[model samples]
Target: MLLELAGIDKQVGADTWLYPLNLTLQESAVTILLGATRAGKTSLMRIMAGLDTPTTGRVLVDGQDVTGVPVRRRNIAMVYQQFINYPSMTVADNIASPLRLSGQRDVLPRVREIARTLHIEEFLDRLPAELSGGQQQRVALARALAKDAPLMLLDEPLVNLDYKLREDLREELGDMFSQGRSTVVYATTEPAEALLLGGYTAVLDRGELLQYGPTIDVFQRPNSMRVARAFSDPPMNFIEARADGAALHCQGMGPVPLSGSNLPSGAVTLGLRAADLSLQHQGGDCLISGQVQLAEISGSATYVHAQTPVGNLIAQVPGVSHHQLGDAITLHFSSRQAYVFGPDESLLRAPQMEARHGSY
Candidate 1:
């Protein structure tokens, strides 16, 4: 299925819900809608699934316009953030609902197969109300998968699940969606989820399509500050500075040189990822000394929040370590790894800059 959103824009009364935008979804491909809260991801997906019509523009499926088509007329199945299941129905019956509606007599095997994939087979006989939040969500997913529609739309389906279950399901679903001739459009607020899915991504902000490209490419080479913020976990570190020839004159800090930069000398914003900035007492042009404000340890990484001369910044370090609050620390990173954004938040690096030096 070739899905094309041409000049699509949505409005509610006098308010704008989504700005005019165009996008093409390849056949059997997964396109992730990455954004922050209320960024219009849901509205965009609903438009694609034919649940809502764009106030202006066309929806083309395989080159045929389906703009005015209703949800019931489209061959798409959707799973939402909130659990949507027949509360009175058992998990088995819930998974089998779509199959039974289509007159499939052998529904038991299909129901059980999907249940096992989602690791909810043991609770197949329990009603939705009897299962935990995660289990009910699995049942909902199973039902949607049972439909096997050509177009699958998932709107942050795992957002309501517990952290562990979300991790487990994300991996499982990533594997499940990799195959099959289904064109998938998944909407989510988490950047990690989009990276885990490993597909093309469309970054959205304030109803605008900020950037669209391969997931890794967009993640590493965010087109602007908006896209960078939307695709970062623990958020991105920013430094207010002015371009000085091939370097930046950071406010309250010294000038830092960025070789091979093509930016014009002017006010700019320097963006660096928390993980990109190394936590160490090292000397470098990109070094910033600060005192620890908070250190959050997650088994695999430690997120240290510190106040530096530039501003409050966070650094994600490998492994857990004991760093007393108010302990002095220095954050260092290579100048090439930083992003140079113009006063308007538009990226100012040469086209080859990201390809040559950008890292996650």
Candidate 2:
């Protein structure tokens, strides 16, 4: 739909809700608003949906200014974290509401199709009150899809669903969006969800728009440390280091070779993804010795938290690895895997795209 927000910002009394920012959404594609709570994602989505007017700037759709347009006047659909539905209406009726409102003659066919896609067809005859939370949310989603709006906004629609249901719906929604023509704006705080959706992302922190680009590009090459932290799941690890004479030195850690690089001699922050650190050493990997503080197993992987001389670090190790508390452990990673951030907290150098992405 080619939605654009130019110089947009929001304020309430003496407090600011969103800092000044500009964004232009890619037409007919998903644009994820990726951020944590109070990161201005919901505020920005409300502005886009015409539910809230920006304190400053304009909301443009297809070259037309929609700054003061009310949501009811716009042909867009929205699904929120809470599943909203008519208490008296059956699931089928709820799904058909939009189609019937649009004067479509074959409401049943369209409703059934959407219900089937969302795996809610079995609950077609049930009322919202009679269905499970996950099932009710699917009905809400199905209704929005039936509206066939040019733009669709979902504000953490699956955030309230159970883990398995959320996982299932996320994949389903991704496939559905791919086949549809709607310009979708999905908001979530999950990096996994953003990665699974594989769309362009706009990373927000507090009230500021941090970075916006292709999801993979932004994930692999964060422009700054804040963006990196926002995109990482367990949070990217940072080590204080000094760059000097073709080498980087960390306190209590041996100097690592910084071959053929021109990183100005000064204090810098080295970032390492949790997945990059491993207990098993590979050739040319720098060793990091530490004592295990906690070992937590989640699904098929174990998250090992350790206290090292440099700092407290967490390593995401694959499979079920057994480790006791207070056990001395050594984690290893190639120096090339590190992300070098300047003293100003801006990314100075990122690992090669081929190596960083392909390693996993």
Candidate 3:
């Protein structure tokens, strides 16, 4: 393992912040610390960067303990949600600062190289205050990249940028980091961004790690309801269900013939994602009847909100849709795309589909 956290715990006075946890980070892949606000994503990053001391446990690198080492001693480069740069320095100077401090010659050429990669070369002579938020962020990232540290950390660095800038920067950063030897750990609250990054993920909720695995596996097979809710966009829909012998039963939908292994008997909750449902019901699909309450058009996709017997549900459909308020329509999704949860909110089985999936 490149990096590992053994029995890590954080406590404040009488309150427990992070439960005793363990994590092993891959050497040369991006790892996303995924969760919502107040989920301890930032805290863990801070701890790993040596800005804070853990209440318990140790931090290790290359199988050796480096617990409580100061940030400067750990060859780590970090960028935060808020842009951090030398206020009085030009963008070029800012990017070259680290190189100069390390006694590297030909700093100007290297600075321009990084600036061009981040698309901030035009603003290289401007002070930090003169650039837009996105440009400032790009400068900060360029500075971090210029360092070429062994470990890289980004704490919601793109969150404050505009939508277009965020999308563009994310793509550029993904490409840049994947080709480097540095181990990268990025923190984000957006599940889509994590999926977009396409790496290993540590799912944190309320300071507790719910799951950790490859990005696609954790998203497709969330270990619990908390992980599912964190991994999904627009939230996942659920219905009370029960397993009897070989058939699974849902209210209003009646007893449906579903195929799966270890089908938990007794009370369970069935989880469904909006993207999995089809507006044009295809064969081998289970049906859910509902009245359309609203159709939200966002970009090229449409989100249909509906009131059903089970509860309020949302469906993500492609292209322009004609769904109207109070119009009754049936939503159908393949049984293989269904997610079943036990009474304890633990996943009973993952979605069984193997075809290409439309993500949220």
Candidate 4:
């Protein structure tokens, strides 16, 4: 492991910030810390970089305990959301700042190499004030890469960029990671970004580590309802239900046969993803009828928002459909695709359902 954090905890003022957190970043892999704002993503990055110390636990880098090491002495590079560059200095000089600060007298070649790799070579002679925001950020990244550190921490590096530039830079960063063994710990709240990077993703909520695993495993088999909701776009749909003998009863889809046991009597929330719900011409098993309230067309596919007896739900339909608002339609889903959550909102695995039916 390039970076390891064990039993980490922190507090500020009245709130207990980060809970007992543990994570490891492997060499040449990109580990994304995903969560919403104020989830302590930035705080954890700062702790790992040696800028801040936790009230408990230790931080190890390449088998060395560096919990008390100062930020300047740590061999780690951090690129923040804000473009930190000297307005008076040219791009080349800005990229060379870290090398110069480290007492490396001959730094021009390394600076040029990093600039070229990040595609900012042409803007080397331009000052920070003369370049665009994206260019300035590239300079910041170039500076970070120039250090050739063992670990790179990025805090929403593409926050301010337009969609096109963000996608381009994402690809560039992926390529850069492929060429080296540097460990990367990127923080973002976007689910698509986490899936695209393809590594271990730790979902943080209110400073606590909720779920951590491979991106595919976490997305396909979420440990809890909260983890499932956090990973989806519009989030998973929850319908209050009950188990009646071998069938499950809900307000929308009533009396669907249950494939598992150990269900409580009062109330249970059933979760289904948008992709799991589809429009069916003829009603089949596990079907629910609803009125389309809204329709969103996004080029290749259309998203239909319908008002069901349970609540408002979203369904992803392939290509453009003839469905319109106020239209009555039937939404279909398999029993296996439905997830059952306890009253406390934790996911409950149904082994019988898994064995009887396949996932969509």
Candidate 5:
């Protein structure tokens, strides 16, 4: 492991903000930390970078305990969400500031090389105030890269850029990490960002580590509804449910067939992602009736929002869709696509669900 945290905890003003958390970031791979605002993602990154002292537990890098080390001595580079630059200095000076502070004499050539890599070589003589927001961000990244640190901590580095610029920067950053083989701990509130930079993903809720594992595994098999909902764009659709003697009963989905016999009876939550829901010509097994409330078409696909007895649900259909607003549609799902959660909001991996459904 390149970076590791065990039993980590943090608090502020007598209130326990973050609970015990553990994470292992592999060398040469990117670990994206994902959560909503105020989930303590930044705090965790700060602790790992030695910027903030942990209230308890330990922080280890390459099997070395550096928990109490100061930020300057940790040898980690951080790219913050905001653009922190010397407004009065040129881009070249900003990138070389760290090397000069460390008393390194031969730094200009290295700074130039990093600038070229980040595609900012031409703007080296321009002051930060004269550059665009994206350019300034690239300069910050170049400075971090020039440091040649073993670990890189990026806190929402692409949040401030426009859509196209953010995409381009994401690709560039991915390439940089691949070339350097540097361990990275990235913090982002976007699910797409986490999936784009595929690696270990840790979901945080109220400072607690909810689930951490391979990105695909966590997205496909979320531990709970909360974790599952976190990965969706508009979020997952939830509906009340009950387990019949041998069927799972939902208000709109009807009684879905169960493959096992030991299902707990009572109220449950049914979760279905927008991508998992489909429109069908007729009602069949696991079919739900709903009226289209809105339709959004974007290039090759269309998103249909429907109003059903259970609640509002969104479905993504490939290519152009024929459905229109106020049209009654039949929504279908394979037993495999349905995720059932207990009343306590914990995931219920019923044997019947797994045994019957293979795609979910």
Candidate 6:
């Protein structure tokens, strides 16, 4: 099922919902719509599912234009952020509805199979309202899988779940998607979710399509500061710098030699992810001293906000590290691991692959 959006743009009255953009989804693979709230992910997904027609351009499926075609006429299935289910029907019946509608001879077996995979088999006889939020979402997913539609669209299905529930379901869904043949389009605002899904990703910002490629490729080598900022969690740190003949002169940090790339001598922005900064000094690392502004612990990681001579920066460290407000701290980072952005905010240099460690 090859899905293509050619010059797709949407507008409502005076405000624009989506800028004109083109995208071609790889058939039978998951393509994550990665962005923040109102990044045009849902609007774009609605257009793909035939729920809304683009003000301009066309929607193509397998080279055939399906623009303005009602969603009911297309072989598509969608799961939204909310847990949508038939209140009057049991979980078993909910999963079986699509199978029964498609005239499948073995509806019960198919329903049981999907229910078991989603861990909702135990709640098969119960109504959606009777189950917990996470359980109900599982039932919704089971129903979508049961449809066996060539195109499956999920708009942040796990967004409403608790943290632990979301973590568990994300892993389960990754495994499930790997085994399925459906062309999946899963939308999420979290970079970790996109990385966990480990497929193609399309990054969107303010209704504009910024970059599209393999999940890891886009993450490591963001074409612009906008993509980097959107893909980061605590947000990537930025420091103003100037490119000299063969090095970059960063404020407070001094000169850091450049290599393996050609960047014109002018003003540039240096980007470093919070995860890349370390508290301990390492060989060949540039050190910057600052006073701790705030320290927070979240899920086995400590985030330290510091006010440095150049700018404010955040460093993410492993485990529950203690730091007091107004405490002086020195952060270390390899210049080779930093990203250099030219005047226009385009990427001039990205860290070498080996320098980047661990997953998002």
Clashing residue pairs, backbone N/CA/C < 3 A, model 4: none
What is the clash tally of candidate 3? Answer: 0
lDDT of 4 by residue, 41-88 (tens): 999999999999998999988888999999988778999999899889
Residue-wise lDDT of candidate 5 within 1-360, one digit each (tens)? 378898889988788778988878767788888889988899899899888888999998888899999997877789998978888989999999988987899888999988886678999999998898888998988888777677888999888777776776677777776664678888999887777777778988778889988776777777887787776765778888897655688765567766555468888877887767888643444777889999888656688999998889888777898766799988887665667788988877522232111122
What is the TM-score of each predicted model, taking all chains together?
0.92, 0.96, 0.95, 0.85, 0.85, 0.96
The stretch of ten residues in a row with the least summed lDDT in candidate 1 is 350-359
Put down candidate 6 lDDT per residue, 101-181, tens digits, no spaces: 998877888888888777788998998889988888888888998898999999998876788878877888888788758
Tens digit per residue, CA lDDT, model 1, 1-360? 899999999999998989999999868888999998889999999899888999999999999999998999888999998879998888899999989989899889888888988889999888899988878888888999999889999988888788888888888888988995699999998888888887799999989999998888888778888888888888888889988788888876667788877578778999988887787645554778889999999867888999998999989888896799999988887776778888888878622333311133
Candidate 6 regions with alpha-carbon error over 4 angstroms: 354-360
Count of backbone clashes for each model? 0, 0, 0, 0, 0, 0
Q: Which ten residues in a row have the lowest lDDT in candidate 4?
A: 351-360
Off by over 4 Å in 5: 96-119, 244-246, 258-262, 280-285, 296-302, 318-325, 350-360
Off by over 4 Å in 4: 99-119, 244-247, 254-267, 280-285, 297-302, 318-325, 350-360
Per-residue lDDT tens digits for candidate 2, residues 321-343, read 99988999999988887888999
lDDT string, candidate 3, 111-200, tens digits: 988898788899998999998888899899999999888889999988878887777777778898788578899999998788878778
Candidate scoring better on lDDT of 3 and 5? 3
- TM-score pick, better of 2 and 4: 2
Candidate 4, residue 125: lDDT = 93
